[model samples]
Target: MQADIYKENGFFLDEWQLLEDEQALPTEPGRFLVSLERFVAAPEAFASLPEIAILVRAGDDVTVLAPHLDRFTMVAIEFAAFSDGRGYSSARLLRQRLCYHGELRAVGDVLLDQIPLMRRCGFDAFKVVHEPTRRALETGHLAEVPLYLQPAARPDEQPAGARAWARSPAGLAR
Candidate 1:
């Protein structure tokens, strides 16, 4: 099937790029998105393929098979339903257990309120559901303010010990 490609800000993207299940292995070098299930089923096939990586649903449980965290360019968490928080945990695992340092993305059934939690977990990009208007993608995928300070393995942030913060002086006066 011909995938729907959205273009905005001079960039073109296959809507499936947001979903780990919908994307396919790369035919050429560079960045390639893969289905987490297929990767877990047969990761050896991808061994020869390099320079690019995959983004998959957190439920794929592919972490045990991941050879190198840097090999992946991105990891996308799939939210099959708004109530399904498995994706959120997947994001956290990618940062915690797998030590992934690529663009973590949130895909499928994304809700506005979930953005904050998604970022906290790990997702950096979002593929909002299709809707009317050209800017639907923008309105659907919102960025959270103030980068997370927790001990997370983010792409460009320092890995730290347990997150700790002293009580704010303003609150101590109370």
Candidate 2:
């Protein structure tokens, strides 16, 4: 089944070819996404695979994947359920702490209501399966509030002026 792909620009594009669960890893180098377990089990095999991406589950530690970040062209965080929000923190850490500059995507259980927050958390792409969510994304039906209370991982985004503490030095008085 083909999913609707949303990029940071809020445009729908089908450039990526998702690897199905039943499909085996391609022998030739090409763009592909693999499960975290499969990639961890045999990191060397994927090391040489060009344009490789990995699917990280909510519980998986981002630190373990840090060393191999340079090898991946993208890192997709899996959201098993809409209630599972651990993926948000993972994306933030990958962007703010690990400094992963590649594509950060949200896969599985992606909904229209969550796209705005997901982008703030540093997800640049989304693989949404629901038709309503896809339409909402395509038509700009998302009721996004541009104001942010806290500073986001993206350096270009400044914190809201209301939160003076965000801009002040840790030990300095506002």
Flag clash pairs in model 1.
none
Candidate 1 lDDT for residue 144: 55
Q: What TM-score, to 2 decimals, does candidate 2 have?
A: 0.81
Model 1 over residues 1-174: C-alpha lDDT tens digits? 432332233224653332245456556555556766666667677786764445555356646645756667666677888888888777777777877778777777776667676777767776655443224444545445454555554566553433333355765566
| Each candidate structure's count of clashing pairs | 0, 0
Runs of candidate 2 exceeding 4 Å displacement: 1-3, 9-24, 161-174
Q: Estimate each model's TM-score.
A: 0.60, 0.81
Find the candidate with the highest lDDT and give its number.
2
* Clashing pairs in model 2, backbone N/Cα/C closer than 3 A: none
Best by TM-score: 2
lDDT of 2 by residue, 1-174 (tens): 454678857656555556765677788756888877777777886656678888889899887787889988889999999999999999998998999999998999999889888988999998888899978877878768668775777778767644776557872653
